[model samples]
Target: MATSDLHMQLIAYDYVNDRKTDGGSLAKMASLIRQAREEAAETGALCILLDNGDTFQGTPVSDFLAKHPGTHPHPMVDALNALRYDAVGLGNHDLDYGLDYLGRCLAQFQAPVLCANLKTSALPMIMPHTIFQREVQTASGETISLRLGVVSAMPQLTASWNRHQLAGNADVEPAMPSLVRAVQEVRNQGADVVVALAHMGIATIDEGEDAQNEIVAIAGIPGIDAVVGGHTHLRFPGPDHNGVQGVDSETGLIGRVPTVMPGNSGSDLGVIDLRLHRPENALHPQVVSCTVQLRSVDGETPEDTEIAAVSEMAHDKTRAYLARPVAQLSNPMHSYFALARPSHVPALLAAAKRKAISEAIAGTELERLPLLAAVATPATGGFDGPENFVSLPAGELKRRHVAGLLPYANQVWAVKATGARLSGWLERSALLFNVLRPGDGDQMLVDPQVPGFRYDAIYGLTYEIDPTRAPRFDAAGKAISNEVGRVSDIRWQGKLVDPDQEFLVAVTNHRAGGGGVFRPFDDAEIVVKKAAPLDQALIDYLKNPDCHDIRTAAPWRFTPKLGVSAILHTAPEALEHLGDIPSLHPEPYGTTPEGFARLRLHL
Candidate 1:
């Protein structure tokens, strides 16, 4: 048997929420990491642990770190350091709490933070690329030295998506060229095998700079032996959650280069094994073949005792903070009808944001403009799973419940938009659905590629979505077709919305700052901007001891189409409410491949 010259194991994980429980707790992942290292040791293979960023924020625990910063190490940094991560990359969310805070928090990380595309002068801690020299025991019982190079890059859109946080501090340049340059630079440093830790998604279709979904293109770059991808919060070695064109849901390979994304919230760990081969007289080794796999921290796994013990104090504090009662839900709160119709969750959020905007613009010249609030549930089983839907019963609500409702700490902004621009916004949002053929069989209602969070539900305006008509705009908010128009009968205060009339649209800085492909939002005049997150306003509203029942009125629905029916993919738990929503006329229709149940809606 020919003895293998180099056996290397690479472990990559991303989107850890500093969760100490539920689906993904770094404490639970510690055991899996230890197990992988043990297996690699037994096989005499070198092991490297790399985090693909988005590690600092997600749950209330991480929220605590960002909201209340101190000299102490962030719980996430503590956990990662305890696990001894080799390196990590920066994700857009990592910059959510301002550049200074991000820098301070990352400074405590034992692992080197790398970001090649981020243009900055203040933070010297970030490296473009890094090289590691290691000694590996070959299968033939011979010890040989190996050189491994790792480079990291985040989406160029980080500049826009995190505009509130990165303003006047740093800018993220285009990722593709910058990443390619970093790869070449690392190779020039005498590195044998190269890896790209890409904090971007793998979308088959391109949507320009804001799309920033460049993992597929990154994988095709030469000298990049392997890739660890993030930002999309998707799971690899599984069916593509979104039907992104070029992605192979099963293998996660782009043109033969092996890549893996471990899914978000520390749910799973991405494992890539590379075999290095070199001629006996060669100066460096090259990758021969690579195998990729994802290990999920599912129900069967137990948390590492030592890690749990280390993080127990913080975990207890977070739980206590999250459990504080804020308000009472007179009835159950669910997002099953978030896109299909108005739900109380977003209805309450829009009401609070509308009030906040109203207060912010009370004396301004723009105060007279009619105000409308746009809200969307960030989670809809897209990446958070089927059970990710909100379903708090009639009882006291807590800080955690409110956090679950909105999730991200997105700031609220009131944008001055003309009715025409508002129409375009609604048209762009309608792209979330597929066109319903007049006489066709049951078809999927939503566009798999568009996330549920991107589907905006405008409050203070009533509209009907005509599925038989085609969408007027594409995902990038560009007008794609004239024959198909999904948005129709748009009305304000029981009257038609004038195309030229101006209005104040209550939106998040994420949308107003051009986080999505929504147009006009980038250039729209900002009449009101809140320094605090939208969730804060909600928490205050809920905390009011005199808070009443959350009022949810159905102001929008699908236009009646006699012969067409649609399939709504939702949490299986929503089946119990089939008879409650009269507008949708929903009926259970078995389960989808993603474990979500399908509901047949009679239009």
Candidate 2:
């Protein structure tokens, strides 16, 4: 059994929203773990529970702990130790809080923390591979000892993504070669079966050795038996990945290996069952067949008392800090119609980031150039469902509201970019919308495959997104040849932008560090790196009255197309704020069975 991308949700409660969410939390997933173990025991099988990384960060509880490092014994570690995980792998997000904090977490976890790709002489809490010997009874009533060799690797961009925390702390190696060597070492050590805990998503195309998401390629390695994959928050053996060329989506098989990528945030548990047999002439057990499936967690599932108990103290502490007021909201903010047009969520972020970049590059040659800010909404409705939209009422805003705005700990970065690069950046972002015809009706506005966080809009520029034109980039951010771009009529400071002119754009380090594999930063140099993350900057931005100019800014709009209409899905509560986006000409189109409110917008 495997769980990936838990994101430090040790409790079945949301401190940010102050409600008990059903499908997330370690306490909730702990129930599924127990049931899986019981089911395996009934068949006289040895069940080992493992977790892929992204385990140490995400929730308000983890944020509270990050502010005060030694306040508690690492809430995630307490829950993992209580559940008795066999082995844990590292994800890129697991190292966000800094190396010292990760070292403390590594010491607190009772299980072996495995990372074959990351190398560091400073911290010795990681191992390339580990072996677990367990005794299980076969169908023939024979008891035998099995050696389970576990190897783990994450994306090579780990250091880059968390650039401030990891440059001197560790060196993140490439996943493909690292895992291949680690698997060979495990085989040379006489392990019976090898399992790969890959902290990566499956790539549809065969990207070479250095690509970030390469589980499909990793599964083709020589000695691997079963693979657990993550980092894209996608599920395998399900409809989310239906028609990829090299994968058997229904069976979760890449080539002959059964690969499982459990959905993020404790949504599903990945179970890969292997039936093994030993021939009369063989000295060790051999796998006869393999199958993979996902078990989902719902509201009715019971929470494990032990795991719940392990998380309560820290939960209380986080809730106390969550109530502390950060600022007074001059206006309300909601992501309901962020995709339909510009919303206050991104606008507010742009204001904060732009001000920070201006101060950071003051008096420098970079400051003399045109200044702009590019930001994406984190709370757009995607795999997180309709409730994913940010909804902050006007009043005394608290830290919880800030958390709702931008949850990740992304630091600010100022990069030098040219007009050509900026245009490519906007075009890449325009890939979020599908091509719409002049007379097509009720078409989906955004692609389900494209995440909202990748759809960035530059705050200081005005452009038209031509959904009718082909995109210069694909879904994976790779360039497509001979295609007219989706973004056109690019203007900055009320003037047409020259392709050769320079500009300083403010963005989070995640983008500068290859979060979406953006090409603008391929050879770009960041002039400023903020020590304090944008979360802190946002708090300061909200308290000041000078930053209120972003309240009514609209960055980008669709190219005019008569008699065309499209459907945009948002939260049901979005109807209350329909007045905010008068330009979209939104009309109520009822609700989806999945609870998203559909708004028909004329293109």
The RMSD of every model to the true structure, in order and in angstroms, is 4.8, 1.7
Clash count for each candidate, listed in order shown? 1, 0
TM-score against truth, every candidate: 0.91, 0.97
C-alpha local distance difference test of each model:
0.74, 0.85
Q: Could you say which candidate leads in lDDT?
A: 2
lDDT for residue 38 in candidate 2, whole number 0-100? 92
- Kindly report which residue stretches of model 2 are placed more than 4 angstroms away from their true locations once superposed: 205-210, 520-524
- Write one digit per residue (lDDT tens) for candidate 2, span 1-603: 999999887877766788887666778889989889899989888888889899988888878888877756876898888888999999998888888878988988789999998999756989999998899898989888888899999998786787777777689888888999999998888788899999999875444434788888899999899999999888998887788878999888999999999988888899999999889988667888998999888888888889888888888888889999989876777888888788878988998898888877777777688888999987888888877888888889989888877788889888888898899899888989988776777789898778899889999999988887788887766778998788988998789999999998899989888677565364347777872489988887777845357776887888765457888999999888787777678899998878899998887
Tens digits of per-residue lDDT for model 1, 45-143: 999998887776666666766777777766667767787888878888877777888888778888788999998877789999999898998778899
